[model samples]
Target chain A: MANFLVWVVWLGAAFACLVSALAVVSFRNPFYSALALIGNLASLAVLFLLLSGEFVAAGQVLVYGGAVMVMFLFVIAYLGDKSEESPWSGGPSWQIVGAVLAGGAILAEVIVVVGLKAGDFLSSPKPVTRDFGSPAALGRLFLTDHLLAFEVTSIVLLVAAVGGVVLGAHARQGEDPTEVHART
Target chain B: MRGPDIQWYVILSAILFSVGALGVMLRRSPLIILLSVEIMLNAANLLLIAFSRLHGREDGQIFAISVMAVAASEVVVGLGMIVAMGRRHVDLDVDKLRTLRG
Candidate 1:
């Protein structure tokens, strides 16, 4: 019964993930797309939980679904509807055809490689420790085996934060900073 | 009691990645493009965690965390550029932004 429950949850989350991902692409409004992305991220977090990645699942919800998506929504609202793109207007018809073909080709290749060629090898899940994906285990790895990468990621985040402030500052070449601020 | 096969997870990840690629190609809006990129990154994270489970290790989870950090930073910068461009009254269409085209 537990196994059956797992299968059902897995199927539901997987379907939700795919559908919302498509919704993210197909939605005409950027705000709707951002909302769809949040759904997609949430479903992915469910999948993460099923995989026993408790900490990762929580992080996915907190970071992607919460923080990053709010930023996207804010930007979309700030830009307003003026920047909206008509689905069929901008590019030539061939771009859509090419994109669909390319996507199909990629999907086919992966299905062939992972589903057919390596099927037997990946058919089973290995046994895991009781704390395999717990926060403590991940923290130890972050501090030990992956310390350099962890430190580097922090530096990268700092740089990106600085860059965002610099680029987002309202002052342009000739515009007075105070005036720009006042205008907004 | 075991869950679904690891192969199924991999296939699902692949499908999501392909859909994301399609979005990036077909959409003209940079915001959607960035969102699609996030989808692709999440697909990769899914695969990493699946493999981590298959191997009974924490390494994949750690890597996924790093990926999240990187993705967060990327969004910060990308959105900043988009806002900057919008403020300048520049065209938001990616195709027409050819000033850097050489």
Candidate 2:
């Protein structure tokens, strides 16, 4: 019964992810697109839970779904959703065709490469230990083998925060009241 | 009863990645392009976790966590640029983003 429930949750989350992803790219309104992305990220968190990645799943919810989605929504709110000149007008005709062809080619290559030994690749080597996805195991790895990488990530985030503030402040200082009024 | 195979997850990731790539190439709005990039990043993260499970290793999940951190920082800077550009009444189309002087 527990296994059946797991399967149901996995399938449902997977479907939700796919649908929301499509909505993200296809939605014309930026606000709607941002909302779709939130859905996508949240469902992805659920999928992570199914994969026994408790740490990653929590991070996905907090970082991507919560923080990142708020950033996106803030942008959408600041810059009101200006409808495109023509809906569904993605780009120049040739650009659209090229994008489609390139995406299709990449998809085909991935399918071909992964299909050969996919069965063996999918099966787990052994039953997962109870502590596999626990915080203790992950924290131990972070402190030991992955310590340098973790510190580097922290530095990167610090730089990004400082840079974002600098850039945003500069932009605000130079803002033209005329343009703001025009938009309003 | 058995769980869903890793192949399903992998294939889903690939499809999502492809869709993201298409959005990046075809979309004019810089914000949408940024959104597409986020999708691609998530797709890659999904693959990492799947492989981690298959190997019964924790390395891939750790890498995924770091990827998420980087992604957050990236979007922060990108959105800042977007806000700056919007202030100038600059075109949101990435093709015209070459000039920072405005």
Candidate 3:
């Protein structure tokens, strides 16, 4: 019974992904495309839950489906009433090639993942950690075991944030703050 | 009824992941392409979770959560750049954006 449900969830998630992919291409509206992708993302979270990675599932819901999708929608909202239907045309051939190559890669990945006999890893409902989902064990490792790398990543994000501000900033002919700042 | 194991979940994740990859390649819109990448990242998270469940390791979920954070950061910066590019040149053809492509 449980296995059947797992299959049902897995198949549902896969179907959602497939449909969303088609929508990404077929949709005339970019907003609709992003919306469809959210469906795909939500299904992934469900898949995570079924796999017993509750933390990951939560992250998927909070981060991907929630925050990221909102960001995309925000971008779209900012573009509201722009009255431009931005026709997307550059190369259909490239899309076809990409589809083929991507399809092949997925097929290969499926073979590898499925061929790895799952019986090797029993499903015992064992805690993922000594204290599953405990904030302490996870917290210590994030700040300690991976401390240096984590700090480095923070620096990288800082740089990226600054770069975003610089790159996205637009000034009028006689009102360039960046230029004034540079002069200073 | 035997529950589907990690392998099934992984395989399913891979299938969804491929769909995302296809979305990335096929879409002309940079926004859609970015969304596709996000989808791919989600698929990877699922894969990590599957492995964790199979191997009896909660650390896998932890790792996936961190990865999702990194992915979030990446999307913000990347979309900011893409949006900037779009603003400068109404056309967001990535192929055209490649001035550095020798």
lDDT of 2 by residue, A106-164 (tens): 88888877787677646655568878877899999999999999999999999999989
TM-score of 3: 0.77
Cα lDDT of model 3 by residue, A26-70, tens digit: 576768877887787777777666665555667677877899889
Q: Using lDDT, give the best candidate's number.
A: 1
lDDT of 2 by residue, B1-102 (tens): 156888888888998899899888877787888888999999999999888887889999999999999999999999998888787777677655554443
The whole-model lDDT of each prediction reads 0.90, 0.84, 0.67
What are the TM-scores, per candidate, against the unseen true structure?
0.93, 0.90, 0.77
Note the clash tally of each candidate. Answer: 0, 0, 2
lDDT of 1 by residue, B22-52 (tens): 9999988899999999999999999999999
Chain B global fold similarity (TM-score) for predicted model 3 against the true chain B:
0.85
Query: If both were scored by DockQ, which would come out higher, candidate 1 or candidate 2?
Result: 1
What are the chain A TM-scores for all the models, listed individually? 0.90, 0.86, 0.67
Candidate 3 residue spans exceeding 4 A from truth: A1-14, A80-95, A116-131, A134-137, A148-153, A172-184, B95-102
Give the better candidate number (1 or 3) by lDDT. 1
Extract clashing residue pairs from model 2. none
What order do you get sorting by lDDT, best first? 1, 2, 3
How far out, in Å, is residue A91 in model 1? 1.1
Model 3, CA-based lDDT: 0.67
